[model samples]
Target chain A: MVQLSACLLRKIPGPPRIYKRLQTFRLNARYEGRSRNCYVVGQGYQLKSMQYTRVARKNKVLDFKELYNLRLEAAAEEHGIPFRYLWDGLRRMNILLNRKVLQDIAIYEPRTFAGFCELSKQHQVDQGLNLPPHSYPKIPVNTKGML
Target chain B: MHDRRRVLQWATFARSWWIFDANHQCPFQSANRLCLFLEGKHKPIYHPLSDCGDHVIVINTKHIAMPDRFWRAWRHFHHTQYAGGFQVQRAWQVHREDPTKILKKQIYSTLTGNLLRKGLMARLHLFPEEDVPEGMLRNVSNQIRQVMPVPKTLEDYPIEERESFPRVFEWPEEYVVKDGKEFERQKEYLDEDLSLSKLQ
Candidate 1:
């Protein structure tokens, strides 16, 4: 039970108890490959393992982004518009939305997403973008919505 | 008529930031996809006159794996007004100097018209590898995946499926193959040839 020093604790987030857990994971994530869990690893490799964890934490951002993009793309494909087009179409109609929200709408609120696409299709035809092979349902332009 | 319609469309357009991953993505395909964002071609309300396009922040540009031998065969040139200021670098060399240059250049060419190119390029942000500036990362709410599959490490694969991966054929015991020794021999040959070339 080697008690870690305060200087060693500098710049780490969470309580000391949580930091210990992170430190353990830092060593474990690397050492698990060789069947050496963090606790059994030697003392010298401690700080280095923590640094690896930091770098890996940053890299995890890319992982989340990759997931969000995949979901958005798949949902857009199902809606018969490439995700990019649908996103842009939404932008054109002043309906600002993010990939996560769009993905949720795609899965849970599909009719609403479709309605947004309908408006997007109307805008597309007005601007004359390259329409996909699938015929998009048009939003009926009415006198009431303009005001 | 066209200009008025463009203005009308722009009136209600609410812009946003988009992220694109260039890792292991083809430059041509990525450029085409990016062009839609730059030109606002993704929108039916897109037009030459209006700045209705959203911003794009691209990450993992350093890992762009060009197909075939573009690293050697491709060349980019630079020129200055001085009589002998012309310089050229191969794609590999360009990447070494600045990883984001090729991707930006590719995207720049994909976008149409000189008039809007500068403005459009202003909205395009690129980061080499995974390190993105806080400001660009802050604005990006969503991302677009590359059309093609991005290569992943062995650990990225699911543990359950790794063992279940199908094999096209299994080797017989008599047909055992040496691995590292053959690679070492080829590496030595290549090193010697490279050293000889350097001497020349």
Candidate 2:
């Protein structure tokens, strides 16, 4: 004959170490309660949420590309540098800076972007492009607008 | 050797400038929508602890709309620490005073409780109408329309000939409620008339 000892049963038992970690992994954290009733569904939900997050992570290329383009366009426009002219001239000179960098130079370091303007105009002239020439450093100087 | 995950990671941390057109848009919806961009919650790289939000330029704030009757009913209340400092102003009144305040406050409130909230709010540029500064307009490469239809201008209405058509209700030619006194007086009168009509 053998005797059995009584033991308390846990609703969803897991060691504290693993349980704490799973709790932290909740996607909609606000819905996580102390009851611990969601262990089964929680893991599945966490997985799905993570999967969506991965997709979102990968799609940022387009967003950044557009942002950089806008910044470059705006920065060039300020000094009366036509966007196409600046882009084309830079390409010709192999000054292949991304729009992200171009935008920074446009907003923060106007002087540097201005250099690009001079380069852009000079290149356009050398190439004999028919487009109306924009002056270098169109800054309150005499004979402005003549590249 | 382009890995999908690797490519996303590179883009995820980058930011962008967004445009929010508030013409005829519900303030709450637009503000919440802007919150996503401001907090970078829409990004795959969004971490609650990180600053991932993008810049947003809000235009046509002058035409932002609220549901019918909410303008009067929705009150923005405030108080000073002193006794009897409590005050409540209707939504329309506040909007009338400062066109950008309502949406700005909404978006600000929608941001999660984080240190980056203030910085994100700073990135939000609000303009009352289409007349944006040349500098700000230059950076805007795209536009995001609101979830609702654009408000039609008076010019969009069919010929003035249609103005004379009969309607279920019309504003009395002499109904002047520009002043609070006149408006209160009219409200009382309208209330009595409405009750009498109901009884009839």
Candidate 3:
């Protein structure tokens, strides 16, 4: 019965779990909570490990992405450009680097990161992506004569 | 590679000076925002172990506003670490004793209680009014935006702009409430007329 249940549990598509009844001998020596003490302990450990692995795996990616974005925002703001413009420009230019790599470059290789920022700024200007939001008038009263 | 790394180190850790105009801003709220700059939390490189905080110059502390009743109700406590040294004073009383003391105390309390607190406080320069010393003023490279907008009085508007403001309707010249004495007298007359009708 134990082997059949363990086999059925292993078929579920998730982190692999080890199933062994070696601790049953120790359970027999102690009369703690219930009759099937070893079985209960094994099930508890399996469930806890499965939940922990699932949550940790899911959140680790999100947490690192947030950290990278935060660093990128700070570095980009220092050069007087928004992070949105920098990310968009990088994509348009086919720089093809993930946020993690970009942030690493920002810290260790700031000069190169600054060059990336400048290139993005130029791209934004050329494509007119640097302009104010669509809600704003294309030409304001004060600057109407200049253009 | 070494030279580039050297320049990057200097650029990343270099301290910047920030100026904040505290006119019409609440002292407590202003302290909440100013503490970020004082502790370098505004920078992405902020770590509790790192001392990368920036210098902050706060001007017009004399004009800091407190919410209604806070001036009289809020009490600041201090202990001199001696017998009978415990003292308490209202926010306004402290402000009267020193115009900049309220803001200074607020910022001090908001900052984390750590060994670096004293060093971080040293970077903060507070002026009661707009008269910053020439040397300190020269170092300012950026301005922290004010938490609240300074309200504009009628006198602040130019006459041309005031006259050009569009209005849906204008008050009648003889509106009784427009003249305080006339309004009081009209109210009294109406009361007397009503009393007479009741008596009759």
Candidate 1 chain A lDDT trough over 10 residues, lowest sum? A138-147
RMSD of each: 27.8, 18.0, 13.0
Residues A94-125, model 1: lDDT tens digits: 77787667767765576787776677766776
Error of 3 at A14 (Å): 35
Per-model TM-score versus the true fold:
0.48, 0.45, 0.54
Please state the i-RMS of candidate 1.
Answer: 10.3
lDDT of 3 by residue, B101-139 (tens): 999998999998989999999999999999999999998
Candidate 3: misplaced stretches above 4 Å? A1-102, A105-147, B1-5, B81-85, B159-200
Sort all candidates by DockQ, best to worst: 3, 2, 1
Model 2's chain B TM-score? 0.71
List model 2 lDDT by residue over A27-128, tens digit each.
Answer: 547555642346665666667777988888877877777656655654565556667778888888788897777776665566888888776876666566
Q: Can you give the lDDT of residue B106 in candidate 3? A: 88
Among all candidates shown, the one with the greatest TM-score = 3
From the highest lDDT down, the ranking of the candidates is 3, 1, 2
Clashes per candidate, residues 3 or more apart or on different chains:
1, 2, 0
For residues A16-135, write the lDDT of model 3, one tens digit per residue: 333345454343434445434566554565556568889999898998787677668767766656688788878987788999888888777778987777776665555566533321
Docking class of 2: incorrect
Report the C-alpha lDDT of model 1 over B15-52, residue by residue, as the tens digit: 87899988899877898888777766555334456777
User: DockQ of candidates 1 onward, in order?
Assistant: 0.01, 0.02, 0.21
